[model samples]
Target: MPFGGEPPQLLKQRLLYQGRRFSFESSRLRLPNEQEGEWECIRHPGGALAVPVTPEGKLILLRQYRFTVQGRLLEFPAGTVEPSEGPEETIKREIEEETGYRAHRWRKLGEYFMAPGYSDEIIYAYLAEDLELLENPPGQDIDEDIETTLMTVEEVDRAIHSGDLADAKSISAFMLARPFLK
Candidate 1:
């Protein structure tokens, strides 16, 4: 209702591209001023992320190479939500697959759009505790190249401040869960 009056009228929506993970669409709309305009957006199924903490109070993170960024980034374990999968289920599977660790306790941190202006990719964040390393955990995804690291809360804070951890979703997830972290 903040955009003046009623929602803008959608005139048309055309799929511009489609990919395994997401799709792009262009839309024709009539604005509140009754003027026509067009816009493009990326449609995604969204994702889930976890801030995993061990009993010893160390945080579990991933140093993963991201082709788009052209560098390895420190991030929480995360994955896109598959059809019929909730955020919790996605995060659980992702943590095990990515870190070889499973969690016995979990709490919801919060959720936010990764980039609301251009994409509809919401990421649900969780705080995972009571972790145990599996003797034979499921292997990581075929496409993933990752290395695991254990860091203290202080280290995470420093990394965030120093720009060592620059992934938006990971940073948002950690900050959301920080108040609940020990």
Candidate 2:
């Protein structure tokens, strides 16, 4: 009955964390063969990323230290989508918050799972054009230390090929955007 039985089905779910921003839960389920199991899953608010294009046709990138990766990474402007907010609204807010730039037009590039194996977090990628710099710098989180870098599309391409840019989201977004380049 190892592989022949049907998969598990959720029977009951209990809220674990119900904060002002997010909520967490634990699910109890019954397998096809009558076995019971429990799984913990978070109902994330989702997120968005912005591949911002400068007025000079350059891409705006950010270099920051990712604790989970134990190293610094070069990535596009991105942030978590607030509860009850649309993807476009999230991207616009994230771009402004991370890079201090306001995008006039936004094109949705694609959506992907951050880590499909473990979490159900979905991230929507976007291409932002017609940008304007904010008079004030972005107000980063207290623990966040990010440096913004403006690079030409060619520079980003070279970095990807040279192993300088290693973040998955950045690489994927850049690849998706390659077709639009001249």
Candidate 3:
């Protein structure tokens, strides 16, 4: 069967909560067994992330505080996809804002649903190279307290193994770009 059997049908949807970046929606679904139930879904506009590599074979990463986790995390430069903005535009802007580097080259690595079970958040991953430091980078957001860091591929591997790089999105983005890294 195309959908493995009779597909569940959406009967109704109601917004439970709304936030700046996401929303919670409750959906009523009719199942294959003719049972009806409700499921909560986290709706998001998704985002883009860049695994930036310098000509010197170093990777540009971010160290930022995540309030949700109540701790700092090491992550790649990333940003939410604003309405009417493409993924590439979001990543380019984010890399420059977060790392003060502009990439002359970019390659679409892949995309993944970060948390499929609860959230409809998909992230477009990109590999960025040919970087040049921006002489006058745009001012970073006041709410952001980001510290940019450069690391060799080996250093990144060590961080991954040591669990120092625990941001799931960044780890996944790095893995996607690993094959092309020097």
How does each model score on lDDT?
Answer: 0.94, 0.83, 0.92
> Candidate order by TM-score, highest to lowest?
1, 3, 2
Task: Please say which candidate is ahead in TM-score: 1 or 3.
Answer: 1
Q: Which segments of model 2 are wrong by more than 4 Å?
A: 1-8, 14-42
Which residue pairs collide, candidate 3? none
Q: For candidate 2, what is the lDDT?
A: 0.83
- Between prediction 1 and prediction 2, the one with superior lDDT is 1
lDDT of 3: 0.92
Model 1, span 13-116: residue lDDT tens: 99999999999999999987999999999999999999999999999999999999998999999999999889899999999999999999999988899998
Best by lDDT: 1
Which has the higher lDDT value, candidate number 1 or candidate number 3?
1
Residue 48 of model 3: what lDDT?
Answer: 98
* Ranking, lDDT, top scorer first: 1, 3, 2
Q: List, in order, the clash count of every candidate structure.
A: 0, 0, 0
lDDT digits (tens) for residues 63-178 of candidate 2: 98889888889999887787678888888877887888899987888888776554577888888999999999567777778889999988998888898998887888878777
Q: What TM-score, over all chains together, does every model reach? A: 0.95, 0.79, 0.95
Per-residue C-alpha lDDT of model 3 across residues 83-124, encoded as one tens digit per residue: 989999999998988889999999999999999899999999
